[model samples]
Target: MTTTLDKRPPGAHARPTPPSKGRGFNLLRYNLLGGVAGWLWLVVVLLPIYWIVITSFKVQADYYATNPLAPPTNPTLDNYRFVLENDFVRYFINSVIVTVGAVGPAVLVSFMAAYAIVRGSAASRFLRGVNGLFLMGLAIPLQAVIIPIYLIIIKIQMYDTLGAIILPSLAFAIPLSVLVLSNFVRDVPKELFESMRMDGATEWGTLWRLAFPLTRPALVTVTIYQGLTVWNGFILPLILTQSPEQRTLPLALWSFQGQYTINIPAVLASVVLTTLPILTLYILGRRQLLSGLTAGFSK
Candidate 1:
């Protein structure tokens, strides 16, 4: 037998071996408790949604006769038809208008204010004070100041108008929007700002070209959040507006429930209809919203 001479460097370390596949399997198996909890939570959340959708398709008689969780034997469109014929279109349009009007201005103003605060707070005391004010607003719940808001709306002669709803929504939206957006703006590296300045970019130009694109995820997050708040808003609409023509979806849904108190299927159908737009919006911006929220929280 011949001994082989060692053919290696004097002190080179050996590479560590990769993890075995079974190790990953063992780790997953150890997390069975978390997996079980997650599944249970998912079922809890989805069960109500499933019932709402199934019940919307049921007739009033079947809804009473069948199991609450059971699917309809003979689904009907009459409930949806009844809801639609009862000024659903008008309420939808009002919601759209209020949502767009309020969210647009709120996001725009908040974004600009956030950028300003991030870029200029070092040199400006007013901006710092404004930021503090915004943070303070977060602690002020809508319920606390709703009476003052109502009085102001009345004083301004905006009572019972869509403007009444839009103005307060805009005001309430700003505080949280500013908080979320300013954090995202702060996360941007100073080097980028310096580079833009060295290239002779004006503040406005830098804002629109650089910061705006980078902060789009944050914008989408804010937009979705504020839109949902405004869309599902009941109190403002309830207190500010009374006319059927001026009613938003939430208020309309309340009236619909009262009108069809005995018709459970129609009530459920109206609920489904009111929820669809919001659900669609969430679906569209879900990825951006999640990423934005993750980034916001991580920072």
Candidate 2:
């Protein structure tokens, strides 16, 4: 009563199967959804920038009469001419000096200090406590210390001078710069330093010649970040400087608005002009900026 099943011969023809319709459908759906989402996100981010650029070109009548969303029928460069002619260029130069002066020193000092902390002998408890105290700077509000900072500036006779803005900006940028650079420096291979040291290279040589080259992206990132911070800063300039000649672009823009009295076209023009340099820097340094901000982290 045993039953045996017969197998087909090896050379027999086989039945055909249908294609994987479900998998193909899923992939197509995902791609379509992702495209829609990505487009929406891009529009969200770029809309304001688009509006600013458009507003900068429109005449006062066009700005008031036409739909803002519509393209300008009459675009003019006169606003840019006026801003450049009326001391905006001067304010821009002042801002450049302050930003460069602050960020350069801040980055330089932070690189050395942070590299030492990461590669040198482990910090002592006392040194550790002091470092902890510095972190308190990040927690403290700038407004809380504004009065004291102003008083100190006046006392030091730096008031109304570029130094007043540069010095405080440098001080504000230091703690976070150190914190970021320390972590990045810690990730640089110890063998690199050891190899250089064995060849009779001094610590200074190792830092500048070895560490700095590899850390360029991070440094550039920090420079851009802190530079923008200093460039846009208004309170310090407002408190420390009174003369129009000493004022930075943000202060200048404020004054321009006051003088123009609801002249929307001029206001928007100033806004566009004020934002241009930082925008240019971002475009130029964006790659390095991203790398520096995210270096030394797990993938």
Candidate 3:
């Protein structure tokens, strides 16, 4: 390599020093501080997960006698035994049915509605209004309309049935899902959609064959998000269903929390068990879930 040194005198501004810093900050120190904060956050987030898993295995007697954070000296299956005998599995099944039932229709209907809103907004004033309404729904707190929801269920004779939970959860899931999917759909290239039309493809044909494949990531994102919401839902299950068989996982936690006393280990076990499926779901779809959520922000 050949070297060419500047022949300018020492005080001749030195070619502006090439900015030995970016924006006048010490970048390495800033990055190290950020790394420390991130690790601290990881520890904070993992601590509860650790405690719940460890506590779930401890014998109820040993749980009280030993330090709260200590690993069980004699870890036993007794709590799992107790949970199963009391129909924890049935609770799991009921949650599955409710979650699947609610999320399926929610995702499907939301996709269709979002497609219509995004594609038709240019031609139809009404659909633009409809999209506005859905975005508006994001502001309505769930607690505010919950009383009306409960009353509607009672009037329809759906109270105490799984339908009571499914119907409302589906309704609430739609607004957010439509908002997300519509953004994803709208971001689709205009040329691609027009090319399908040029080939004599019907609107529905274009939707399934073209829009769907492109938006699959957003769909998976919505499914996992809505499924988690409906799976762990407590408020709807609490207010709508009364029978033990009707109970979802959150409501079923009462099986471990007695009126006067609580089985802490068993309760934690139920929590850990209930969360496992959702954790698995997130693990599988986490990439798509995160990407879909931030899909349009880049533009």
Candidate 4:
């Protein structure tokens, strides 16, 4: 009997291994199905926004004369010019102030409260109950409490001011931000707390220096989430502020619609302006936001 061992040299051509036909077909089928489902969902979600955008660009004639589905034949920037010259600038500024003011306090307070709930020795059923109450806040619609809020605002003499808007916005946002941040906080490993304590770090020091650094991504996620909410809040500002100078972008846009006529182009322009800041913010924090959400959940 002869023992044969074939030795192939480096870079020698070897017999080609045939790909698995079944596996390839399955992958192709799955990808095709996924692509179709995703595309359909996108179209469903985006069509309304597309309509608003298209209608906003339409001139007077196209708005009234042309079909709704047809593209505007004589699109113009006259509406945007009108908005810019009129109330848009002041409204935009008011929006920025209220949104910034609201988001800052909401995130800060929620973060502190969430940390307490997660790390405090006193964490118990009562604490859970309180947290539940705050969670219940998410279920309570602003409209249901609008009248009571108005009455309280009137009693406190805060109505028709920026404070009126900011106060209510903070109240509404705190619950959800707390809920989100608390879940994120609870995910932190106990080893980290033990390590910090062993190092003789104070509670404040531990939170600020150790835990906070790890929670940066989650903080960004909560900030961006609440920032959008505060920026786009309409009902609170609308009811709370009567002065045109105090109105935010949403209220100003609402006022733009009249019984007699509506400025289609300007409304679109204002929308584009209002939307730009949010889109820019999300883009800037996209990585942090995504990581925070996924990582927090995993933890």
Best by lDDT: 1
Among all windows of ten consecutive residues in candidate 1, which has the lowest summed lDDT? 1-10
Candidate 1 residue 4 C-alpha distance from true site, Å: 9.0
Q: Which stretches of candidate 4 lie over 4 Å from their true place?
A: 1-27, 43-59, 62-76, 121-129, 259-262, 296-299
lDDT of 3 by residue, 225-292 (tens): 89989998999999999888899988888645663156788888777888898999999999988888
- Tell me the lDDT of model 1 at 179: 91
Q: What is the lDDT of residue 204 in candidate 3?
A: 99
What C-alpha lDDT does candidate 4 achieve relative to the native structure?
0.83
Tell me the alpha-carbon RMSD of every candidate: 4.2, 4.6, 3.4, 4.6
Global lDDT of each candidate? 0.94, 0.85, 0.88, 0.83
Per model, state how many residue pairs clash: 0, 0, 0, 1
Model 1, range 1-299, lDDT digits (tens) per residue?
22266555667656799879798888898798789999999999999999999998898889889999998999889989989999999999999999999999999999999999999999999999999999999999999999999999999999999999999999999999999899889999999999999999999999999999999999999999999999999999999998899999999999989988999889989999999999999999999999998885675
lDDT score for residue 102 of model 2: 93
- Deviation from native of the Cα of residue 214 in model 1, angstroms: 0.5
Best by TM-score: 1
Better of 1 and 2 by TM-score: 1
Worst 10 residues of 4 by lDDT: 257-266
Q: What TM-score goes with each of the models?
A: 0.90, 0.87, 0.89, 0.82
| Two-way lDDT contest, 2 vs 3, winner | 3
- What is the per-residue lDDT of model 2 for residues 1-299, given as tens digits with 9 covering 90 to 100? 22255365656655688888789899999999999999999999999888888888888788889998778898998877777788887899999999999999999988887887777537466556545665776887778899999999999898999999999889889888888877778778889999999999999999999989888888888888898999999998999988889999999998899998666777888899888899999999999888876765644
Give the least accurate 10-residue stretch of model 2, judged by summed lDDT.
1-10
